[model samples]
Target chain A: MNIYIGAENIISPLGSTAEENFGALSKNSSGIKKTEAAGFDKKSIFFSRFAENTNDFSFDALLKNCLKNVRSKISPDIFSSEKTLLILSTTKGDIKSENVNPIGKSVSELQNSFELKHAPIVVSNACASGVIAINTAANFIRAGVYETIIVAGCDVISDFVTYGFECLFAISDKPCAPFDKNRTGITLGEGCAAVVLSSHKTIFNVEPMRFIEGTSGNDANHISGPSRTGEGLYRTVKKTLELAGITEKDIDFISAHGTATVFNDDMESVAFDRLNMQHIPLNSLKGYYGHTLGAAGIIETAICLQSMRNNTLIKSMGFEEEGTVKKINIISENKKLSLETVLKTSSGFGGVNASLLLKKS
Target chain B: MNHLSSYCHISTKEIVTDKGALLFDNTEGLEVNDFLKTVYKKLAIDYPKFYKMDSLSKAAFLGVELLKKENAALAEYADDEIALLFANSNASEDTDKKFVNSYAEEHAPSPSLFVYTLPSILMGELAIRNKWYGESLFVILQKFDAAFFADYCNMILLRNAKACICGWIEITEGKTEAFIFLAEKNGNENNTPLTKQTIEKIYKTIMKQSRPSKV
Candidate 1:
């Protein structure tokens, strides 16, 4: 069973659609800027936030907005079909409003408003939530449980999360510079994005790409810290490639989980080095879209699809010098390339890492 | 040939297995912490990390440890061949509230509490204890859906894993319900297909046997 993935949509600070987001990326325009007294300590911090004037600021609103946009690109009947499933990925869903049960009401609203035949599966596996949600969708399709799945990832910024990171000293004071020497920490952002995966490629309005396969691995090291050996990320990529019957040589680019935290970037660099994939073109969009937590994976993967469609590679914005102990090629400028196969990977707080491969169909 | 091998359940006051035997119980109306500690001590698994775990992780750790005790073969499998699938209705709400109170009431946020805010961190704790590198996923459904677990475990078994430990560990307010079952690609002593009905039957039996009146 071949999984076809496309119909990518996003509602981020940069733009409202994947094409629009890619347009901003092509011109090297970033969404990150300093917010006044945003930190827990009343320190101004860099964040990618929507204008106060926008209507899609809340968690539920952004999810609805992105889902409606995605619905426009696919067949209308899929949403109500029993064979189609919706998988929501988020670290914290509406936590600021309903801390007692953050995700339940939002998920219920999505099901009722969208008229989905079945309840959606809500994934809250920290940052890897988005990546794992996509993988879970593919598994469902492959097992014939569902013919189609809409993998939606959404998260909104809140004082609760901000203070948590602030207490841990993880929030960057300036714009995050992924894989850069001076990189401090992540600048949290908020957004909603989704992609469609189906056994029937015709459901997609645009030509869908082949979703080869994906897998996850655990570092088994620490809950809040990344593994120095990148054990989980490396093993996941290895398993994914082996399952897809490919190698590092077949990959044209990598959309890495460069959180800009010293440990995370270096850990990824170490993993890429260990995999002997140092020569592949790689970039982290966190610089443009800040670290959107659960939405980061889906948003970045959508941009990867755009990169494939346009035959262009987006730069690792905010990256100037080689920083990691291991040497991996980080794109510093936008360039054109015939991208045939690409890989996207994400590692999060729970000692979890995930990877997936996309090939031109 | 995928089948349910072993299962363990922990209600607010009782700890029982699928073998028609109660391993332990708290008839004294002890607090959640004290009850879990009594079970941990009975097992005599002296891993100090238990003290640091949130109530959710502590309960799950106890569940898995008892599972290993019942099915010794669980440890025989290769590390990467065993996967962990856990979920809950409330996520880490108990810890979330605590973390919030740390900043809102205590005037300072604690990093330790913030680290355990995500429910999947409990899965991480399990992975570290066992050193398993297999695929792990934690999902949130509105309630305990045995059908979903069966579907997910079947999907996971399609991968390289030979066995999977699926759990629904929910800890909220003063309520606690932890149930974990092992699904093997092949049956060991007995054969019970890993279907929705089988999982539901087993969990229901445990629920009925543990608290009796509460469930």
Candidate 2:
């Protein structure tokens, strides 16, 4: 049984739709900018936030808007169908809310607004939430628990999160330069992205890509720090390839989770090198998206779908010179290529690493 | 069909096993952290990292520790054979509030508290302790749903993992109710079949007997 994935939607600083974001990416546009006095110490910090006002409830707005856009792209009957289940991937949903249960209200709001057949399951595994949510959706479809699953990943920029990162000194001072020699750290961003996975491809108005296989692994090393050996990332990619019945050589491109923190990009380089995928052209979308946290894996996967559709290799936005101990073929220029199969990987806090494969179908 | 090999429940007042055997009762009226320390001492766990973890991680660690104590064969599995699938209602809300207070009231964001803001950190703690590099995921549900756990655990066990350590660790508003269970391919005659009804029954039975502990 093959899971078909399509109807990709993105609500980010770059644009509201996947096509628009892809267009901006093709032009090497970055959403990151220096915000005045956004840091805990009142220091100017770089952030990739929505240009339009989100009216204080950015989390809710992003979800509602992204879902509405996703609803438009798929068959109308799918939303009302009992076989469809909704999964929300978020690190923090409305953290600014006074209520202790920050995500419950948003889940209810989304279900009520969309008239979803079932209550959405929320995945909140730090930064890996998005990819794991999509993987969970595919797992459900394969298990015959649901025919169609809509996975939405969203996180908003707030003082709560920003200050937390700032305290940890994980926020980059400049627009994040992932995998670059001068890379500092992550530039936090806000965005929401959703994709529809189904057992049948006919539900999508556009041609859907084959949801090959997705898997996650833990580093078992640190809660906050990535492993020096990239054990989890390496294992997940290997597991994904094995489950997909493919080889490292078959992966044409890699969408790596390069958070631009000196350690993360280095860790990914080691992982890819260990997987013998060092030669495969890879790009970290963080240079453009600025590590959008929970929304990253979905948005980047959505971009990969668009790349497969357009047959274009989007450049690693801020990468210039090689940085890591293990060399990786980072795409420095946007080029057209025959991308048959692409691997998307993400590593997050809590020692979580996830990888998924998507083949052009 | 998968098997619910071993399970442990940690509530505010006491700890219980799958057979309704009381492991430890909190007669000291200790706080959340103190209660976890008491359990850790009772189990004779030497991992000093337990002292550094937040309430959610402590609860989950204790729950898993108790489960492993009951199922000695679990330690024989390969490092990457066991997966961690945990869910909760509030999602690190207990720590989130403390972290928020650090910046809002204390005038400085506490990095230590901030790191524990995600509930998945507990899984990381488990992975580090057990050196299990298998799959790990943390989901937020409005309430505990046994069907979701059974179906998801079955899917994960079929495709990615050989055994799964699943839990519903909810620590919010000074209340801790962590129910951690292990699901494996084979079951002994005494083990229960992994099903929604059995899981719900076990959870309810544990919750009904728990007396809320004072912080």
Candidate 3:
């Protein structure tokens, strides 16, 4: 069964809609900037936070707004249908809550607010949450469990998360420079992005892309660090391509998971090199999005869809020179590309890697 | 033709298998960490990384160790065929609280504790220990829904994974309990058909034995 994905929306510091975010990328603009006293030590730190995020703006509000936007893009009755499920991808949803149940309350509120018949499944698998959630949806659709599933990913910057990263020194002082020679570390970001996938294409109001296949693999390595050999990423991408019955040549562009952490970018480069995909034009949206944790996969995948729609390739922002030990083609400038198939990849804290394939259909 | 090949459960009070055999019992009212440590010693497994894991991860790790001990076939499966699917209601809450207090009170953020803040890091520990490179997911549900695990196992058994390990772990203070099982595509003579009804039956039966130790 060929699953279809459309009715996508993104609410990020770059912009609210897919068009605005893509436009900013086309202009080579980034959302990351220094925020005053944002660090645990009361020092300034670079973050890609929403300028419109007033003190009143909350995580629930971001999800509600994004869901509303995507709801309008697809059939109005889908949310109430028993065969439709909402899959939420978030690393830390309201982590500041005293209860420490980051997603339980939010899931309940969403179920009540949206009047969803099926209880939403929450995927909190660190940075890979978004990609895993979408893959879960795709699996359900293929297995005839759910005809349509809405995958929403969101993660807001919190002091708990910031302090943790700060202690690890994983946050960059300046904007993140993914796949760049001088790339430092991640710049925290916050956003909510949602995409709808269905077995029936008629449910989508816009032209849907073919959801080819997606899969995940564990690195069986360190918990906090990416594999030195990029074992998990290589395995997942290989499995995805094998399942889709396509070779590396079938993928036009690659949406790489360039988190800007020294080990991360190098690991990704190693994976691509091992797969013999080093020559593929690839870009990392982290320079613009700042590694938005759970939202990174969905936000970046939405950008991939838009790249297909506009026939434009967004450059790897903040990248200047070759960095990794292995050689690869990194998009250095925004240009037109006759894109047909693209692959999105994500690697996170749990020594896990995930990849998804999408094609213009 | 999916089968519940083998299962193991660990709590603060006891460690047992699905065949109603008590592998170990705790009467000293040891805390969760100590109880799991004793169980580990009883199993005579030597992996120093065990101490670095949080209570949740330790529980899942111990459960997997027990599962592998009972069913040698699982240890022999291809590394990518044993998909690890785990879930928890609290989701590393105990470690999250510890990390939060480390900064909020001591004004010192501990990176080691912070790394275990994600619930799925337990799966990482398992993957590293067992060298199982299969697909993994750590979902957060309000409660342990047996039917959900059964359906997910069935969904994967037919497609990618040859065996699925649906692990459920929760460390609520001293009341730490973890249940892990290997669901195989082919059944053994002692195996039960993988179904929602069988899973619920096994869940209730195993959960009833996982009593809390008075810390």
- The best candidate by lDDT is 1
Instruction: Give one digit per residue, the lDDT tens place, for model 2 in A179-246.
Output: 99999899998888999999998999999999999999999999999999999999999889888888
lDDT, model 3, position A116: 95
lDDT of 2 at A323: 83
Better of 1 and 2 by DockQ: 2
- Clashes (backbone N, CA, C under 3 Å), per candidate, total 0, 0, 0
Q: Which ten residues in a row have the lowest lDDT in candidate 2 chain A?
A: A49-58
> In order, what are the TM-scores of chain A for the candidates?
0.98, 0.98, 0.98
| Per-prediction TM-score to the true structure, in the order listed | 0.98, 0.98, 0.98
What ranking emerges by DockQ with the best candidate at the front? Answer: 2, 3, 1
- lDDT (0-100) at residue B209 of candidate 1? 68
Question: Cα deviation in Å at residue A134, candidate 2?
Answer: 0.6
**Predicted structure 2: clash tally:** 0
For candidate 1, lDDT tens digit of each residue in A1-361? 7899999998898899899999999999999988898877788988898887656578899999899989989999999998999999999887862364668988999999999999999988889988999999999999999999999999888888889898989988789999999999998998989999999989999998889999999999988899999999999999999999999999999999999999999999999999999999999999999989989899988998999999999999989999898989999899999999999999999899999999999
Query: When superposed on Cα atoms, how far off is each prediction in RMSD?
Result: 1.4, 1.6, 1.5
Least accurate 10 contiguous residues by lDDT in model 1 chain A: A93-102
Evaluation by lDDT, superior candidate among 1 and 3: 1
Pairs in clash, predicted candidate 3: none
